[model samples]
Target: MTAVALVLLAADFVTKQIALTHFSGSDPTEALGGLLRFTLVFNSGGAFSIGEGEAWFFTTVKIVVVVAMLVVSPRIRTPVWAVSFGLVIAGAAGNLVDRLFRAPSPLQGRVVDWIQLPHWPVFNLADCGVVCGSALVMWASMRGIRLNGTRESDAPAEAGATERTAEGRDR
Candidate 1:
């Protein structure tokens, strides 16, 4: 989990720096026959630029998410769960760094976003991590996989049988 988080965090940081250096103050750059574009954007809000000017709120949320993930990481016994948590942690921390240290002042700074697709908002690698990680977490939960790597279907049959027997007697 630590490895995954660190790698993603580093990648996000490096890419954002590169984007800032190359894309800032320039017109959007197109590639892949206009399928993708590098358009520099500094967002002070949440996803899709919602709640603009709420950088402080987003920063607080990211801090809480990072700390919560770290506290709960030890109980994740499955690789999938570990990766899911790691992605989320790295994503939150990546954006948190910008909010806390970037231009405009601490806790009110804008996040650098440069990647854009047709009809889509300009976003960064950290946004990708957050979206993908959240999807994975939902998938795991729907599949009944627990934090300790146990599935709902893995529960002992004896417990179900005992419950049935008790219900029969009560009737």
Candidate 2:
């Protein structure tokens, strides 16, 4: 899972580089049949350019988020959790590349978003990784699955406590 995550991250970085150099044009170029486009737009804010021009702040926030995820990710053990963390790692690393490189230097770098849906905001591979990974984690959690890698059942303690209480009542 770590290997897969790193590979995905590397792929995201490489693809972004290509976009920066090749597709990072002054205009948005159609990559697929309108479903995809190689648009060269720089975002200095949050997802979908919510806070454009705030490069420094956003970069700092991103770094913090990535670092936090990296630190907490290793504790995740289940296969699904591992995959989810990997995807998140890929996304973080991908965007981190942009924050580290690109024009204007340092934390002032802009994110490269290209893939665009007809009705959705333009996004990139990294963004996809983030969204999918986050969703996986959320779904797993809702189903009572642990994201911390622990294999213990979620209801074990509750059930045990209930049994103990019933025994006390009987006594």
Candidate 3:
């Protein structure tokens, strides 16, 4: 989980740096023939560009999320949970760094977003990590997979059955 998070964080950082350097002050760069484009943008907001100019609030939320993940790390027994948490933590931390150290001011810095998809908001790798991680978590929950590696069995056991009744004879 740590390794995966680190790799994802690095990818987010590097890609943001590339976008900042290459796409700023230029027209959007199309790739995959308009299926994807790189459009440099600075967002002081939350997901899908909402909460614009709420950098401080978003930063605080990111901090809370990272801290919460750290506090719950010891309880992450299953690999799926670990991956989900790792991705979320990494993505939060990735944006948190921008909020802390990027331009404008501390806690007021804008996040660098560049990737654009058809009929979708412009986003970055961190967004991808967060979205994918959230999807995995939702999927696990729907599949009855618990964080402690237990699954809720579909087969129902006979409730209120006495030992004699369970022995194939009526009590």
Candidate 4:
């Protein structure tokens, strides 16, 4: 899980760097002629251009969300849920890094978003991971999957241990 998280974080960072470098001072170009485009835009806010004038608010929000996710992620019993949480965390971490240290200001840093698709919002790799992970977690939860450390047998063992403890206490 840690490995996956690291990979996703690294990939997101690298791709963002590439986007920043490649499209620094040029108009967004469609590499596939309207299918895909490498566009350079600074998102000082949230998804799809909303909250376009606030960066600090979004940074604080991300921090709170990441912390919450970390606390809840470990309690998820299923591997799928864990991985999905990991993906979301990694992606959030990548963007958080940008928000903290990219440029212009601390915690007021803009996210460098590129990679446009037809009729979709312009986004980067981290956003992709977050969205993908969010969908997976939602699906897993809908199917009644637990994504925590507790195993199915743990309950029975715990019950047995409690019985033993009760018996010992009565003696």
Question: What do the candidate models score in CA lDDT, each in turn?
Answer: 0.93, 0.78, 0.88, 0.82
RMSD of each: 2.2, 3.1, 3.8, 6.8
Which residues of candidate 2, in runs, are more than 4 Å off?
Answer: 24-27, 148-154, 159-171
Per-residue lDDT of candidate 2, residues 43-118 (tens digit): 7777968888787887777678778878887677688888888888788778877877876788888888776777
- Cα error of candidate 2 at position 150, Å: 5.2
- Model 4 agreement with the true structure over 106-161: per-residue lDDT tens digits: 99898988988989888888888889989997887676566654444444465578
- Model 3 residue 126 distance off true place after TM-score fit, in angstroms: 0.5
> By the lDDT metric, which is better: model 2 or model 3?
3
Per-residue lDDT of candidate 1, residues 1-171 (tens digit): 898889999999999999988885369889999999999999999999999999999999999999999999989999889999989999999999999999899999999999999999999989988998899899999999999999989977775798899999999
Clashing pairs in 3: none
lDDT of 2: 0.78
Q: Rank the candidates by TM-score, best first.
A: 1, 3, 2, 4
Query: For model 1, what is the alpha-carbon lDDT of residue 77?
Result: 98
Worst 10 residues of 1 by lDDT: 20-29
Model 1 pairs whose backbones collide: none
RMSD of 1: 2.2
Instruction: Write one digit per residue (lDDT tens) for candidate 3, span 114-156.
Output: 9998999889899888888889889999998877878877535
> TM-score for each prediction?
0.92, 0.82, 0.88, 0.81
Question: What lDDT is reached at residue 113 by model 4?
Answer: 89
Displacement of the residue 5 alpha carbon in candidate 1, Å: 0.6
Instruction: Name the top TM-score candidate.
Output: 1
Mark the 10 consecutive residues where model 3 has the least summed lDDT: 155-164
